[model samples]
Target: MDDINAWVWWLVGAAGLGIPLVVTAMPEFGMLSVGAVAAAVAAGLGGGVVLQVLVFVIVSVALIAVVRPVAARHRTQLPELATGIEALKGKQAIVLERVDGSGAGRVKLGGEIWSARSLDGTQAYEVGQEVDVVDIDGATAIVM
Candidate 1:
């Protein structure tokens, strides 16, 4: 009976850990929350005090080391910004209209039209000149 209880405890802990691992590997599941639940189950099913602490530490550390980087990489692959004309930075654009001292003009970049200004605030950009976008200010790009 004692041996059966120990086996049950170990089986429960293993199942807890294994379920989360399998579920998280699926593209549709979120890993961090799943890992947390797994760690909790491992600790809960560890049977005695020493086993509980050991299982908790081992499961928690393993899950963190394995799952966090995956989540971070997944997050980084998504777009960081949702709006505005900041997409024009570091791209080359052609001046469609001359920009005078007042800093108002139009440019074509990446097959899209954009409002542009000179970064130096002094150069008079002429029509049909290729320029590099250096900064974005609201709807305007500072180009040079």
Candidate 2:
């Protein structure tokens, strides 16, 4: 252990930390990997083991404290645009068939025909009536 250069060990530690970071896709490990790289830089600059460890600790703590919150915020952020069936909700559709709880009906939504059911089982829509899509239930649209 004493034969190997300290900087080489630090770089190796960085690589070791980075491997798990990639495998697990965890930001914390990435932060630690970056800290290991900083430690390696300290060792390369002739800083002793204690100084290298200090550098690693400081860099890792700083990244966890600062970057982690921002990353979490981005992870939980709402998408800028909604795609797929989500885009169908709240849209206006024209009924193509009589809609009721008694039977399945059809509607023209976003230029596509979709199975539709009345939001209230008691209510119904005749052909050519306009309805608002409340939500999507499987391949069916709940409309009112």
Off by over 4 Å in 1: 1-46, 64-86
**Candidate 2 runs further than 4 Å off:** none
Local distance difference test values of all predictions, in order: 0.68, 0.93
Candidate 1 pairs with clashing backbones: none
Candidate 2 TM-score versus the reference: 0.91
Q: Model 1: which ten-residue window has the lowest total lDDT?
A: 27-36
Native-structure RMSD, model 2? 1.5
> In every candidate, how many clashes are there?
0, 0
Angstrom error at residue 1, model 2: 1.2
TM-score of each: 0.53, 0.91
The C-alpha RMSD of each candidate to the native structure, in angstroms, is 8.0, 1.5
